[model samples]
Target chain A: MTFSTDIHVDKVRALLQAMEAGDERCTVEILDDITQIRKSELHQQLSELTKNLHQTLDDLDVDTPVLLHAKHDLPDITERLQYVLNETQKASDKTLGSSENTLGLLEEVGTMLEGSDEVSKIQPLLDQASQELTNIMLAQSFQDLTGQVLNRVILIVTELEESLKALIERSRHDYDAIPQKTQSEAEQSAEHEKGVGPNVTAKSKLDAVESQADVDDLLSDLGI
Target chain B: MQINRDMNILVVDDFSTMRRIVKNLLKELGFSKFDEADDGATAWPMVQSGKYDFIVSDWNMPQMTGIDLLRHVRADEKLKDTPFLLITAEAKRSQILEAAQAGVDGYIVKPFTAATLNEKIQKIFERVAEKQNK
Candidate 1:
């Protein structure tokens, strides 16, 4: 039982004026038209909103898992985050091990220096320490790997947030509102061809290889 | 033919950290000359301009993909014989097959050890030498 504000007010005023003039037929006709217009307007609004919502849902494929089901994508995100945690942990362990070994080598060098200033004796120890330090630096590569994974997760989350925001904003407006445009099919499909960065859950997937050995085996079988 | 330890190498990856790790590993393997590119797009220009003896690349990148770069290199009459190795996180059999089909000299999945990289590089050089001899 809703009507557009200006139209409803003007129609009611016209019907009252008609009634005052003892124009019963005119008043009845005005009332009928008002009811018909309101019904049509409401129906149009409902259909428009439904269409916009459908478009939003269709455009919400940020990733394969997100495209399939949002709930299903949650566990995948968790697994990706878990991978980040494991990578960071391994990096820290490697860094610590290298640092400790470097420290031990430095201590040995210090003792040798205290005993005698032989360049040959100190050089090997210093070289070993330098190698360990390089190991420490290499271990920091985990940051890059984990950062890429987080960026992907963030992208999916951001896409979901934007879709939800659009839905909310559209729901607040009437049927006469312009529809939000969606991404083209070509653009969405192109994202699939781009390589999926670091398979965090490779162990669980049958299509993905878990190790370099697996890759080597496959390549050898192909005679490469 | 003996592998040249002093040969110029081009390392292509989007991540600077990865490039540094690869460079350090190569240094450990006695390779002294090195160059780096952030992606295949940037690497392709360098590959065209420079006389790189070897190319190591990552698969996924924003502007151009490693596989595309590999194809470009292989198609070039002058650079077709340059050794190209793919080091990437893309471990699918299909992707490995694609690299092989595109004439990749070596393929090493990410999270690979220095030993694996060394082994792959040695094997690639050996095969290239054998092909040249034939």
Candidate 2:
């Protein structure tokens, strides 16, 4: 079994040690009391980490993929998120282009009427034009608000960037603590072809949740 | 064990995020010579055309896969011995075994960090150097 920094609470660790050494009375209750608090704590950290990482990603102008629910699934979410970001940017660009076109039309009309003595006739036309101008100005004003909202997102993202960097760094440290097998697994893929890709091993991921006790054991078998 | 830092690096994956992540990691590792392809199919011709010294590829991609790409690389008289690393999320014993048999220069399981990449790349370089010595 892998040592969990997560399950490092004194009481829980002690309980696990006590229970592991204990005899047949070792029931689900032992697993429960020791792991319950730690499990909940881990759940909290995961939620917090996800929330922070996503927020930071937004600051970096990244989108959260609709399909991303967990870590093992990042590849899918990253793909979908790219599409989402692409579509969003396209829509935003279209909106800005439409607004710019309206502004251009208004500018041309204003320029044409600049020296006309038909100020009275132009006055009524100008009234309609001026109303349209106000609408354009209002729209432009809303654009400023959009820009401000973008800035706020940027601010929050900066905060999350530092947070996630720390989290990843900490995880790396934890990973280093886990001993890896000395044997080389480098040449085996050529010798066999039955398994899928190395990155999307869903079996291990599923096995992660249902059986934490088996996590280290299985990874060792995988030579990781 | 040194990677020719100036050599062109190709980052291939169906996921743009991963491509970006790998690129960024490469940049962080002080190598900015890079390009990207979304899958091995799209990446194949580029590898054929470009003088790529290092290729960091994802195992599972849309058009072509890392294994097929690796085989293609080994088959090519010109591209042989170029470093080919497969980075993936799969961690099953079976898949790991398969990648080994494919003669991948190095393998990295996903959700990995910059440091892990450093370790794998160094090990790959060392292996390559050892073989060259022999």
Candidate 3:
């Protein structure tokens, strides 16, 4: 993939000669010719670079995870994460249902013992148990919040797989033959509006409110 | 105007876990009647068809977003006055501002305590009462 720069060298020599002779018009013409030669040489170099990249990609082992990830691992990971989401949801719901049933039974027991001197002794303990059960139910909300985070991770993995597959597919053809695709403003804004899920770490906070009070203050400031 | 414990409340989120959690919190608050939707797109038709008194929705979803749903509700003459609350992990000031501008009745950041949910719902109803009184 050698580029012939002899024409470029000849053009540069002609440009220097024209400049030395103080011929302004010839100098200008030779300067334009040199610029064109340099442009074509750059184009040739870029084409060679693209060819080498394609060859390198083609030489990659078929078993490499980058290629296999698009075909197998990524979808497998997505399915596994989805399974996690489903199972956790089922567990949370089961806990919630059982707790609610227990609370109901406790209420019935409290009613059955109402107006007895024994009620005072039994009531406080029952109330404490009820509160604990409620707390347990509330704690199950972790599944929801964590599940949202997991959903985002799964989406990112799927996107990574798609990008890898696209890159691999592109490498099989002439790079410049494909027209460059840019995201339209509408598409970009639509993606922006989709909103990122919960920030997993402090670094990704992006000026987010730290607490309910901060949210309240912002809403108040907005006169809502 | 008093807060209606039996108000037809609609809970919307992409995750069933979240929908259940929000419903459980509402139950803890003594609100019994409720409906659920997985996203704003699903909720929209329900909102139009059902005589919902309030809506509690998540900000991020696949088909449609909470803010867009809020806009739709506000733009609809029939449902404009229904209370809309956003419970989401999107805590950015700009997002809060956007929800406020979209006529969201309340905003509660995610992983919120039951106390916060209770208080926000109470505050929203109080404001709604004030407006009705006016």
Candidate 4:
């Protein structure tokens, strides 16, 4: 359905003209053949475009997500990235504070140990060090929180990749043209026990598997 | 209600760092015994083993999600009574309701604090005590 230079309007008109003059059987056969050839042409053009775009992305050092951002006119990711940076900084500060407090307690204990004969005098400092260590442990929880946030960001980036890939593949007349199998096919080949990744954001989630025909039809309407 | 500090606990999350963090937090709260699995797939077998008295799991994982694991645990007669707490970043009301219907003992949204976890665990224990008293 995509309207491209490769469609060859003259060739299509010739086929239609032949169909009009021929017997019913010959007309049906010629129409089917023309349709198949058009499908193949669309696939070829799509594959070439995808290849060129991929190479351009590589040359520019821009990933598919960046390309998606450009195409979608997405908001800057700087704020999200900045949030991560801030959290990490706060966690590090908490960790350093706890560690330095523990260090001071240790030093006090060491001083008491050197000056006094009784071990009980250092007990209070040891207790304080233990509490500070616990604070350090609590501060360490930031790693997990930050990790989860980063993982969510990673999921977003991956979803962007999927959307971009899906868009490119959509230009093809057939879903089977991509070398990589569809998710369903991959699931079956893996015995259907393979787990899917986390759910993506609402927008990309819908884009994941829109029919190739629909995309081609839209492109055709746009005269692309 | 007095917490059973000796309870055998299973902490499930794909991230090892999260697992360790949760374990340390539990230790701070005076709970010592711990077991860990990276994902719900691995944790399912451990849950089935009937060794753990409590489960604290992250919702999003590679092999099986925490919701899937919770469903499995609830379906199994022996494991049904085990205190299962879900930790998730998902804040959708529908998901929260689904987890509740799936028989999760408690839900904790992520980037949670130690105080939040402790409070939820305490509440779960209180509910269990009330059920036992009834």
Candidate maximizing DockQ? 1
lDDT by residue (tens digit), candidate 1, A44-146? 9999998987777555444333333433444466677767777777877778776877778777777667747586677786878777677777767777777
Model 3 per-residue lDDT tens digits across residues A98-213: 99999999999999998988998999999999999999999999998999999999999989877877787776733233332345967744644677666543433756788888
> Which portions of model 1 show Cα errors greater than 4 Å?
A1-69, A118-193, A202-204
- Predicted structure with the largest TM-score when compared to the true one: 1
Q: What is the TM-score of each candidate against the true structure?
A: 0.64, 0.41, 0.54, 0.53
Q: Which ten residues in a row have the lowest lDDT in candidate 2 chain A?
A: A61-70
lDDT of 4 by residue, A78-160 (tens): 34454565667777777778687777777776776874677677667677877767777676777677767876785686676
lDDT per prediction? 0.79, 0.64, 0.83, 0.69
Worst 10 residues of 4 chain A by lDDT: A173-182
DockQ for every model comes to: 0.69, 0.11, 0.48, 0.10
Pitting candidate 3 against candidate 4, the one with the higher lDDT is: 3
B1-134: candidate 3 lDDT, tens digit per residue: 46889899999999998899899999998999999999899999999985799999998998999889999999999889999999998876767887888888899988788999998899999988898889
Which lDDT value does model 3 have at A74? 66
- What are the per-residue Cα lDDT tens digits for candidate 4 across B1-134? 79899999999999998898899999999999999999999999998889998999988788888888999999998889888988765444445556666788777766678987898799789888888899
Evaluated at residue A25, the lDDT of candidate 3 is 100
Can you rank all candidates by TM-score, best first? Answer: 1, 3, 4, 2
Q: If you score just chain A, what TM-score does every candidate get?
A: 0.41, 0.29, 0.55, 0.33
Weakest 10 consecutive residues of candidate 2 chain B by summed lDDT = B89-98
- What is the lDDT for B66 in model 1? 93
